[model samples]
Target: MGDFVKEILVKPIQYADEVVKLADGAISFRQDCLEVKTKSEKLVSLLRQAARASGDLYERPTRRIIDDTEQVLDKALTLVLKCRANGIARIFTIIPAGAFRKITQQLENSIGDVSWLLRVSTPADDRDDEYLGLPPIAANEPILCLIWEQIAILCSGTIEDRTDAAASLVSLARDNDRYGKLIIEEGGVGPLLRLAKEGRMEGQESAARAIGLLGRDPDSVEQIVNAGVCQVFAKILKEGHMKVQVVVAWAVSELAAHHRKCQDHFAQSNVIQLLVSHLAFETIQEHSKYAIPTKHAMSIHSVVMANNQKNDMDVTDANYRNNEQDDECKSKIQRPRGCQRIVKCTIW
Candidate 1:
């Protein structure tokens, strides 16, 4: 069967499909290829070879490589997982940090969307466009779609929409409980840190979110901190957009959740101020509800760390308690609540 596949099925794709017999033969070969055992060394070699071959056709039929890549990835991922079924997780334990770093560089270069790129990396950093090529203006949606497709292969068929793949990676980073088993402690961190520094606000936000997730794992957190992810997040907190602000705030909170020292670092970086300011102006219900208060808590934590300033900052006040009550009343009355509590009534 392997010989039949190599001879009758695989060999014919190389020739012109002018005759009806050739097209039929190619179809039969594709079917045979699909039926090949996931553990077959031949299939693995074929996939790797096909990927390399796609490179030679780089200038022409770039789309063919893209299409073939999709097929190859789909098949290879199944094989890789099957190979890992037994103590495969142990393989990553021996894999060096530098090895994961190299793979991550190649992965980022192959991505096709800049906005999607930003979500996956740092918003302020420049991308390696020379390797990825200028993002096709007409291909934004399609590239984003393909990026998600690749991510889905990594995720266990749980992700259907590609848009969620980047977010899923971020989520993986934040809560090692979800994907820490499949992904190495260092597997997702390097690309995330690099993204945390480059591209656009959306990309950086995504990377920051992942960094935050990665920090939840004890092993991952130490490496990310050692790699200076916190410093990058602090920079974004000061200069990024609302979405970027929210993710960075969450990432910092996750880092602080694991280590008290992170609070002190954030304080020294003046990130506490930015978090406070963002909480002050945030209006989106989700942002105001989760992010703003969480950031405020982190800020107050920073204050505590900086001065032992156990100033009894009311948790309710920190929760935007006054504004929320007013909103609740206004919604019930169907009218804007006017200024009603301006009298000087000190809580003495």
Candidate 2:
């Protein structure tokens, strides 16, 4: 591979032409470019070689190639981005994630600024479960953060800074939107709930709806309820948009089943009726089965205890107790005279 890269690097113009031709498709393009068919196979091999090589010999040449846009290397960086954007997937098992981030940072700098580079780093929503199994950085923080920050910049930033501070203001949450520790602490649920309450119609609507989903987590609701958020959600339900209404109703149902105080308050506010009405249309009988064990267990215990009291059967009577056994057996066979009236009242 090093020999191949050396061969290509010697004639950089030819390498550059192939790289650009491969990446020149339209932005909305969805086709896969085969590495074996194009220079990607060779280029990926070269990247690995450059990574493995030590000292200034590798750095100087790699920097020169990355820095010069007039030749093949510049086009090669663009090609990597295009290949990634078109959904050419790979396992990072052979290559470390940090190496990928570093290489990608160089490519990001080389591309100047593109609106859709934002979308490239944003992992597919359906891919979240797969991502969560990855190491911490790849799963939790910078991947989504990079996407958010990039889109924020591309959508609203000036030429100098290139970020939408307003979008981050209204929508962003810290730490990959985990909302666990944050929602449990003081002031955790406030920002999202406030966004729903006070942000612009679109921002507020989305924020409010998100708050409703966040409410499903028990710790989050306990903190939000303790902070007096239910009333605010109730008001939002009365006047929020259709999406907000749907989310708020779902949120209310979640709150209702978990916190009795919240359920009572929601009932008094009349939101429970609305949530119940919605549930009637969407409910599955299996959904109610989750809570059945606790109810069934309580009912069985109550019936057993009540029947035992009404039976008047001695746990150890003359039929079971032996007089010759000991004083312990005699004591066990008799109830104390002081308890006679109580036993008669309960058992007879």
Candidate 3:
């Protein structure tokens, strides 16, 4: 009994120590971007908090504490991976773009090593069992293989896995129009919509971006709408984290641009009002492009006008008048002055 108690008590402290080491290693990695460095620092702070919290446990840690610690570690690791990916992408896009090949190769190797370390370090009991004993599926098309792999990860992997997979899918869809169509045809939309509606912070952001990218294809617009993406986007826009809200805004805007039915879906979901409310926040005002809200307002306005034109009966006159008033309000609302840069960015 004594030995057992000591083992139980010592394990958490040991795990905490490992986490600190991992955090240190992550911070030591070259972070040329300010965003990457800030994220690494924030990750270290979270790890410290988690370590302190774990150290307070004299016995075996409670379920709640273990879960909480796992959540923090998952978030930290996801941020680190995301920062590295972003840095790699940025290097590829830099002007003159010298040494990008070597830089990306190094970054990719580092990311692989870190990801492997994180997977192994995670407690066995916490690991998802669905990946066990599954034979890998082979495909002729590399993109199809990637889409399938990400779908599998999203379906049954941990939060970190889902987040990483979603981000990869987003990048894949963004880089190729054909890939986006293939993703839609391969039943990627359902899983992506599921993640967007029910995933963690990073998962939600990636899923929204993937959906947005997929929405760029006009053929996928109705499919996305049918998957209840508009409702999910409206909810995310209203209450999600800042990064997610911005992505969701862009996504819904893309969907709205594709077809009139998508616009109708957004109007029915009250997405216009939700977006208008987002304008009240300074963070949203800064990060969000105005094209989304501007286009959304126009979509809603068109819907109301069409409704009024169809319903000319005396009994519905009052309803038409109400809609007209709403349209007036939407029309009179001016775009934010800071949106000039966003417009230019979108155009380019």
Among the numbered candidates, top lDDT falls to: 3
lDDT of each: 0.43, 0.42, 0.56
Name every residue pair that clashes in candidate 3.
none
After superposition, the stretches of candidate 1 with alpha carbons farther than 4 Å from their true spots are: 1-163, 170-178, 181-186, 199-204, 264-348
lDDT per residue as tens, model 2, 1-348: 334434434443444445546554423221323331244434444443443432212222233343342343554444444454534343322333344344444333323211122222233342332322222222345444343333333333333222132234324433334533433332335545555565555555444444544554566667767666667666765676655565555555555555545666666766655545444433432243233233444675445544444432353454356555455544643212322232222122
TM-score of each: 0.35, 0.30, 0.44
* Superposed model 3: Cα runs more than 4 Å off: 1-139, 280-348
Of the candidates shown, which would achieve the greatest TM-score relative to the real structure? 3
Please identify which of the two predictions, 2 or 3, would achieve the higher lDDT against the true structure.
Answer: 3
The residue-level lDDT of candidate 2 at 264 comes to 64
Clashes of each: 16, 5, 0
Candidate 2 off by > 4 Å: 1-178, 183-186, 257-261, 274-348
Ranking according to lDDT, highest score first: 3, 1, 2
